[model samples]
Target: MSRIAKRFAETRASGRAALIPYVTAGDPAPDVTVPLLHDLVAAGADLLELGVPFSDPMADGPVIQLACERSLAHGTRLRDVLAMVREFRQTDSETPVVLMGYLNPVERMGAEVFASAAAEAGVDGVLMVDLPPEESDDLTGLLERAGIDPIFLVAPTTADARLSHVAAAARGFIYYVSLKGVTGAQSLDPAALGARLGAIRAITELPLGVGFGIRDAATAGAVARVADAVVVGSAIVRLAEQYPDAPERFRAAAAELAREMRTAMDAARADAAPAAV
Candidate 1:
């Protein structure tokens, strides 16, 4: 099984939602990326989503946009992100890493070339924000051939007909944007989200991960009750923004937040579980 599938299966068996933390590659500094990845894993992350810095991250809010700018300021390229992943694989081979970003970098590198390079770098999945499932056949084929899962995002606004297209194209897991706005936007109602997730669950068997407004343990716990995975992004990346020059501090704070989310998610699941008869 793919690392992602295996991780999800393992987390499922444990009766806990997987904690997936998103951080931008080369944020704060390029050198910090690899070690920060390990720190997050140590903090109880089941999987990691490394953002590939891009010039235009339209779907992202100001926080991640600034993270992209900081990373790009260091001249961090897609190749550099891949190199970080390669270095990360030297010691840890079990945790899955998914590259998340825009399509411009992949198109610049050539989809086939990017796919091969990512696979060689030990990347297990790719989430290109702007690459809709309807237009992703060629690139998705290249990724699958390289043994990489082409992950896709489903929004609250997605129609049932369009969802079928996503279900047909997606692998790894389906990222359900918990809100209508960009990443980091607030106002996540878990009751409403649970209802939406129920609709999505009816359509696909792929693990569903909810993100966009999960900023704290409470939000993470709420999301965990309904999602197979709880994806936390902007809240963690905000640490890099706060400590631009201090990699150690960034690592510490980010890991602490992850740990809190992990603990809360596990507790939430246990509370929701049926009592022994």
Candidate 2:
């Protein structure tokens, strides 16, 4: 089984939800990105999404926009991000790593080239915000060939027909955007997200991950009640910005938050099943 699928199955068997966290590669520098990833795993992150800075991050809010800008200014490229992933995988071969970025860079690198490079770097998935499901065949085919998942996002405003399309294209899991706006937006309502998640669940047996506007343990636990995975991005990335030079500090900040969320989700899951294995 894929890393994400196996992890989710273990989480279910243990009566818990998966804790997925995000950080921008080369934000402060690649030096910080690699070690920070190790810290996240040590702190109980089931999966990690490494953001590749882009010129135009339409799906990201100001916080993430600034993060991307910093990463770009530090000479962060898709190649460098992939290199970082390769380095991280020498030790962390179990946790799934997802490349979160825009299509411009991937297109510039070419579909087949990027997919092969990502697989060599030990990346398990890619999540491009602007890439629509209708236009994902080439990348999907390449990633599937390499055993890499291509995750897609669905918003609260998504049509049911499109949900199935996305579900079919997406591999690891479908990221269910809790709000209508970009990442880090404040308006998050679980009701509509629950409805959309239910729709997605009806179509695909793949795990459904929810993100955006999730700030802490309580929120993560609340979402864990329904979703198979809880993705927390902006808040963790923001902490990395504060400790750019010290990778351990950056990792500590993110890992600490992830630990809290993971613990909460585990606690919440116990109400549904037995103890962890």
Candidate 3:
């Protein structure tokens, strides 16, 4: 299994939700990305999803969309992000890194070729936001053959058949989008998410991770109560935006946010455990 799948399995076995933090790989600068990644893992993130900046990030709201613009302005590219990951693997190979991005760059590189390059660069999994399941068979097959998982998204409004398709196509874990709008919009409802997630759970046994609109400990803790993982995306990306000239300061704040979320989730989980007789 990929490290992401393995981590999810470990967390699920322990009855806890994995904390996955998303950071745009070259937002502040390429030199700062790896250090911030290490800081995020140290701050309690079980996995890190590095977003490759694209010209148009359709699924993202203003925050992450702006982050993409910043990274692109900083000359971030898929190749650059891969180099960053390659360098990152020099010191750490155990912390799962999911390269999340749009399909344009992957298509630009071709399926098999990109998969091979990603595998060589030490990428564990991928979450291609715009890749449809109907057209992802070839890429997913290539990634699987390369020993990398192809993580897919399932939104709250997704129909049953589409959810089943996502369940069938997804390998590492299902990324359950907790709300109806774009990424970073704050209207998440955990009880509503749990109900939507229930149907997807029936379709497959893969761990379900909810994302989009999770910004703080209270929201993360609330979502952690149901999902196998809580994905914090724009919040982390915004930290880079918030401190464009000071990546270290941004990382410090991000770490504190992650630590708080982890603590809240752990405490809630501990409280949920049945009392011994």
Candidate 4:
């Protein structure tokens, strides 16, 4: 099984939602990326989403946009981000890493070349924010051939017909943007989110990962009750931005938050689980 599928299956067996933490590659500094990834996994992250810094991250709010700027300032190209993944794989090979970013970098590198490079770098998935399902066939085909899962996002405004189309094109897990706004916008309503997830469940069997507004343990725990995975991004990136010169401190803070989220998510799932007969 793919690392992503395997991780989800393992999480399902454990009766808990997977914790997926996101950070921009080369944020704060390029050297910090690999070690920060390991720290997050050590803190109980089931999967890691490394943002490939883009010039225009329209889907993200100010925090992640600044993170992209920080990473880009260090000349963290897509190839450099892939190299970080390769280095990360030297010691840890089990955790799945998903490259999250825009399509401009991939298009610049050429999709075929980018796919092969990503697969070689031990990347398990790719989530391009602007790549629509209808226009993703060629790139998705290349990714699948390279043993990489082409992940897609489904927003709250998405129609049922588009949901089906996205389901058909998507691999790995489908990211459900918890709010209508950009990432970091704090407008999540778990009760409403659960209802939306119920509707999405009727469409496809793929794991549904909810993100965008999940900022802390409480929010993560609430979403964990309904989502297959809970993705936390901006909150962590904010820390990176806060401690630009103190990489170790940034790593510790990020890991602590991830650990808290993991603990809360596990407790929530345990409480929600049906009692043994």
lDDT of 4: 0.95
Worst 10 residues of 3 by lDDT: 268-277
Tell me model 3's lDDT, rounded to 2 decimals. 0.87
Worst 10 residues of 2 by lDDT: 268-277
Between the candidate structures 3 and 4, which one is better when assessed by TM-score?
A: 4
lDDT accuracy of residue 217 in candidate 4: 97
Off by over 4 Å in 1: 275-277
List lDDT for all candidates, in order. Answer: 0.95, 0.86, 0.87, 0.95
lDDT (tens digit, per residue) of candidate 1 on 124-227: 99999999987899999999999999999999999999998898899999999999999999979999999999999899999999999999999999899999
Candidate 4 regions exceeding 4 Å error are: 275-277
lDDT of 3 at 12: 76
TM-score of each: 0.98, 0.94, 0.96, 0.98
Error of 2 at 184 (Å): 0.5
Which 10-residue window in model 4 sums to the lowest lDDT? Answer: 268-277
